[model samples]
Target: MEVDHRIRVSDGDGETTAGQGGVVGVFFARCWLRLRSVLVGLWCWVAGFARKVGRIAREDPRRVAHSLKVGLALTLVSVFYYVTPLFKGFGVSTLWAVLTVVVVMEYTVGGTLSKGLNRAFATLVAGFIAVGAHQVANRCGAQGEPILLAIFVFLLASAATFSRFIPEIKARYDYGVTIFILTFSLVAVSSYRVEELIQLAHQRFSTIVIGVLTCLCTTIFVFPVWAGEDLHKLTAGNLDKLAQFLQGIGI
Candidate 1:
């Protein structure tokens, strides 16, 4: 009977099976082979998520509805790119509208409305403030522009952050405030170098508006889930539970 034995490989030997010398080389060669196997089998994971995002996309009816809704919204917004007149009107900035639809579309009407309105109002306010800040920064001259912009960003961002601590603002407008700071910072910084800040802002803002409108329409009209209705139901449920408890005490 012969025993299977590892071949004696030395540091300088060229006869190793992996074509590399010694134990270290053999270990690394085996690890590389294992990594290749993982990469080769990755298609299994990708294929699962490749299901068409249309009506009745999945077994779950709710999930299927959501998928179809999202697909419809995406398709509607994509018209900006497909139609020649719309594409010409918006130019490359049409892409922003598509991105906004993807980002702002939500599962509930309240969620969609909250985010869409927040983003729209924040962008409007930030765009105006950014333009004003840019004008002021311009007067500071090239050397002073960067410094002034940085200072404005720092002060405003800090103030916005502090505002988030208030209970009223935190309950609502939290997302809007965050977006406000983001838009302001981006515009303020970009204005220093980009010559067409005003034009770029206008295009971006317009696209965002379109995106917000699309989200609002799809979430509200397609398969409406009213936030107020949910809140009312919840309140009613709690009242019923309280009444049941009092009835038990009376008995």
Candidate 2:
């Protein structure tokens, strides 16, 4: 009988008597990949976001840059939660909520209450629509397609109706359109289970809440800057440039 002499290797915290380096290499590679993901996220914020803010910074460099820094730092910390092993789910929810609140606050109202209210309403609407669609689909055995189409049409009509009553609706028509799309789109996307829909809604709302809080806290404590400031900086720059041009023209 011939004896084979290839030693088996295991990954037991460097306790393998054979000392194979392959397992160690693999473990190190995984760690590196995770770190790289976080670094990529940071670079994305700095390169794309910071530069845009910096352009606005030229007008009121200190305040604008400070606000931008605070917002980005908070956002980055939120993103890190997703990349890390234990905290990713919470991070995702927080990031989504924060982003939603930020967008709504930028356009509609500029306070924590407004941000929270819009996000909560959006989540509730999504949940209710999803649950209803699920029930209709399960009962009809059609997987909710018919219900979805009807809901979509109804939402569109409702948005149109709101356009007349709410001037903001007409001013920002796409906002309502987006909300309608997202509300029903989830039904088709989800498994059409009431429990699942409820869970999703909870997650959506919870994340939004966390995100809104993070944004508000960061704004107040760290570098509270407003959209008006952003607009003001940009406008002032243009005005200054115009004034300089007029002076050159001897007007």
Candidate 3:
């Protein structure tokens, strides 16, 4: 009787141990599968990104070069602010130059030039008007200055908004008109604080010019990409594809 009892107890213990081992094995197997699935997803993303980069390099090398040039130009402009004392007085406004670069730089040379020139010209004209308006308002005394300035902003903005819709101007100078409105608003509104409008305008203008010149020089000198060239190539390629399709259809 005692020997039978001992054998039964031993068998029960062995069964429990085996069951625990099986559960542990299954848990580890599930963990490994989850980890493997995550790794595979990450690898697929990396592969897709690499393939896209490869396609861009093979199909549009100029685009790649232009991107690099833009990056270099931004870096150079940033370095100027950090290293040059001339930019120190600009305070937080120094970032305007960087913003200008980002806004003005285009994939094509002519587009960059057109946009940059427009921005510079608009800012110049707006700055002068803002300064003059502020000076005139100041002569009207504090009580009347706000009213006069408000009226001036309203009139100028209305005119600019209307002018933006003109066909010839819309085609080219729309961006300039937008910038003019923006500059005028900024300068005119800030003038009430008695901040030196002329100095502020000069700094903004100089930084913008720097950004524009940097972009223009880098794009023009470094394996320039012309909008006209890209348009021509695209047109030719489309025509050829159409011809091939028509031939395939026996049309």
Clashing pairs in 3: none
Residue 47 in candidate 1 has what lDDT?
A: 64
TM values, all candidates: 0.69, 0.49, 0.80
Clashes of each: 0, 3, 0
Tens digit of per-residue lDDT, candidate 3, span 1-251 = 45322211235446323355566777999999999999999999999999999998999788789889989889988976797675676655677789888999998899999999999999999999999999999999999999999999999999999998899999999999999999999899899885777888888888889889999998899889898998999999999999999999999
Cα lDDT of all candidates, in order? 0.85, 0.59, 0.88
Task: Report the lDDT tens digits of candidate 1 across residue range 1-251.
Answer: 99745565545755554333456776899999999889878866666557544334454365566668889988998999999999888888899888888878887788888889999999999999999999998999989999999999999999999999999998998989998999899889889888988898998899999998988888778877777887898999999999999999995
Best by lDDT: 3
Clashing pairs in 2: 93-207, 97-208, 98-211
Q: lDDT tens string, model 2, 1-251?
A: 99644346566766344434656776899999999999999999889987887777685655664557446645654663556752555534555654664564332125544545555565567657656656665666565556665665476557645565676754544454455456556544564433555666666667666665655555555545566776898999999999999999999
Best by TM-score: 3
Candidate order, lDDT descending? 3, 1, 2
